[model samples]
Target: MSGIYIHIPFCKQACHYCDFHFSTSMGKKEAMVAALRKELLLRKDEFKGEVVETIYLGGGTPSVLELHEIRSIIDAVYADYKVAEAPEITLEANPDDLSTEKIKALSKSPVNRLSIGIQSFFEEDLKLMNRAHNASEAENCIREATAYFDNISIDLIYGVPDMTNERWKHNIDKALSFGVPHISSYALTVEPRTALANFIERGIVKNVDDEAAQAHFHLLVDTLQAAGFEHYELSNFGKPGYFSKNNTAYWQQKKYLGIGPSAHSFDGVRRAWNISNNPKYIKAIGSGELPMETETLSVTDRYNEYVMTGLRTIWGVSMERIASDFGERYRNYALRQAEKHVGENLLYFKGDVLLTTKKGKFLADGIAADLFMVNLS
Candidate 1:
């Protein structure tokens, strides 16, 4: 099944650690929305033969848009493409933007899922990350949102500098208290040029400790698993029947069309991304130009990607499929590359599927890199 991802590249303010492309100004919000709708109409043929099973509104923070604006965008999708009868429509939101009135209004919209950006429920952490919402708003939004939406996911971040193990546990516990069916948690990494990185460079903030991050990840897994949450992905936990259909489709290498500035799209063979400049993207779309770049995936590229994404999820890499899809040469390369990690008990086999061990989940990315086929013919 195919999906559509709409990137809303506007936010109320910039977060210290975020490296995603977005603007703090809403000056072109109206023009951006128009561009997005037009871009959807312009790209309808891309998914002409495919049924859209998910429409994910991600961003700078989709909740910043008005209900009417959000509706107009969804309406645009319906007017052009053939969508599934009950598509999973998700909107990424921030706590401060999700007022009780807004939450009530959204329950009546086509959006069925809410991925709240409640990164931390502590004032100190919130201030450190420059999150728009305070600790109370974070707790309040989820408490109210759970009353309206059952298919809800909340984001949490661990490994913030000075975030003790106890504080991390409290964050997870606070999220569980809201009864959200899904939780996506990640260890904070300071990307270059972000405020967090600059802070570290100037010794304004302590550097992220890898050992502390690893400890937080283990604690998260144990606690969530005990509380009946499946560690479905390296950074996602969900109850049975509540995993994110959109994200799951992505991990399985399904095709998706990304609309709006700085969005990326993937067909079965090629990947494309829109330009990141907002005004430029708006002008290009208005002039009926896609303003995007495309690349056809080589066999090696596809194999490497599959290995990377597959290892990060519970659906480990399939040896037989690798052999059939990329030939035995590539399959043997993978097996040989995986041997060291397997010997270390970081990777093990379940029948023909190569999966990560509990001790290896936090290091999945690093281990997957070891299995990458860089020079295979």
Candidate 2:
């Protein structure tokens, strides 16, 4: 089964570290929503025989849209695509936008899951990140949302300058108190061209310490694992049966159609992404043109993608599948490249499947790079 991801590209404000495509202005929201519906209708034949098992609304903040507007998008999906009997529909929301009434309304809507962006439960961290929601709003929204949505996931950030390990622990403890089934946490990375990066460059903000981030990651893994949440992916921990179907499909390299500006899509062999400019995307869709670009994956591109995604999740890279899918030479090259990591205890073999050890989980990306089939066709 395939999935559908809708990107809502409007936010109340910008966070200091975010580089995702979005606009703070709501001037074109109505027009953009219409364009999104039109895009779905336009792309119906692309997935003619595929059943959509998951529908995800992600972006600047899907919560920014009105209830009817959100419903209209989903309605468009159902009207055109063949959806599963009970698909997992998720909406990525922010604490500031999730009022009590909004949560209640969403609970009754088609959205079955909520991914709340509560970067931190501390006022100082909230200010540092320039998050739209304050500490009180973060806690209160989760408290109210848990009552209505059982499949709720919350985001937390770590390694902020001046943030003590004790404070990080409290953040996790506070999240657990709300009984959230899933938590997605990431280290605060300063992306280039973002406010956070500029501040660091000007010495206004302290540079993010890699050592502190690693310590925080280990603490998170130990605490969450003790609490019975599986470290299903490198950065995602979920209780059994609560894993995100949409994200899982992504890591497994399943087919998905991404709608809206700056969104991306994959269909096993080809990958495509829409234009990042909202006005341009809307105008193109209105004119019956797809404002996107596509590229067919080479054998090496497919192999590298599999290695990158496979090593990050519980399911490691399968040597047999690699040999069959790519070629025997590619599989042999992977084993040769992985020999050093295997000896260092960073990676190990479970039969023919190469998996990362606990000590290696945090460095999965770098390790995957080492095993990448570079200079191969």
Candidate 3:
């Protein structure tokens, strides 16, 4: 099934480690909303009449907007697309932005899922990341959100320099105690040009230790699995029937239309992304033009994408689908490459499905590339 992703590129404040497209200045919030509505109408047929099963409101922070602003965008989607009945509508929010009253109001809207950015529950961790919310807000917001919504996903970050093994366990325990159905936990990586990176260069903040990150990764798997959470993806865990449907659809290569600045859209063959600059996007859209660039995927590129995404999930890539889509040459090449990894206890074959073992999950990205078929015409 296809889905629609709406990007809200505005944030209340800049996180030191965030590299996502977002502006701390919200002067263009109103104008950007109007422009995005126009952009949605302009790209209405991108999905080619597929029934949309999901609509995700993601961004710098979608929860920062007023309830009415969110409603207006949903109203626009209804006006233009054939949305499925009881679609999984999700909005990404921060802990500080979600209050009891706000959650109560959001429950009244069409949003059925909440993805809260509760990165860490430790005050020091929050300070290091420069998250606007404190530890108390993170704890209370989840309690407040569960009161109104049953389908809730919270994000937690691990591997910070100050996050000891015991502290990491505490973070996982906090999420488990809250009875959160879904969680997306990530390791802290310092991207280039970010404030975190600069701090490291100046010796202000300690650099991230890869060994520490790897240790925490193992800890995450063991702890969550024991607590009855399935490791569906490398970075995601969920109880039965609580896995994220929208993200699953994406990993399976379903078509989705992404609206708003810096959003990416894919429809099997073509991929497009809107401009990252807010002012430029607004100006271009106001002039009745779509400010986006398109790329046509070659066969090799498509196969590589399939391998990259399919291998990351519990459901591995199918040998039959690979043979049909990319011919025997590419298929046999993949199988032969996987043989070495399989012998190393990193991957295993179940019938035709090629699944990675727990030992291989952390290195999935590197291995996906090793099997990639490059320069194929």
Better of 1 and 2 by lDDT: 2
Report residue 306 deviation for candidate 2 (angstroms): 0.3
Clashes of each: 0, 0, 0
For candidate 3, the per-residue lDDT at 45 reads 75
TM, every model? 0.99, 0.99, 0.98
* 200-278: candidate 2 lDDT, tens digit per residue: 9999999999999999999999999999999999999999999999999999999999999999999999999999999
The per-model lDDT (C-alpha) reads 0.94, 0.97, 0.92
Residue-level lDDT tens digits of model 1 in 1-377 = 99999999999999999999999999999999999999999999899889999999999899999999999999999999999999999999999999999999999999999999999999999999999999999988998999999899999999999999999999998888878899999999999999999999999999999999999999999999999999999999999999999999999999999999999999979999999999999999999999999999988999988998999999999999999988899889999999999999999999999999999899999998888877764
lDDT of 3 by residue, 1-377 (tens): 99999999999888999999999898999999999899888888776568989999999999999999999999899899999998999999999999899999999999999999999989999999999999999999999999889999999998898679999989989998989899999889999999999999999999998889888999999999998989998899999999998999999999999999999999999999999999999999999899999999988888999999989999889999999987888889899989999999988988998988988998888889989987686
lDDT for residue 298 in candidate 3, whole number 0-100 = 89
Output the worst ten-in-a-row residue range by lDDT, candidate 2. Answer: 368-377
In model 1, which range of ten residues has the least summed lDDT?
368-377
* CA error at residue 114 for candidate 3, angstroms: 0.3
* Order of candidate numbers by TM-score, starting with the best: 2, 1, 3
The numbered model that scores best in lDDT is: 2
Model 3: residue 271 alpha-carbon error in angstroms: 0.7
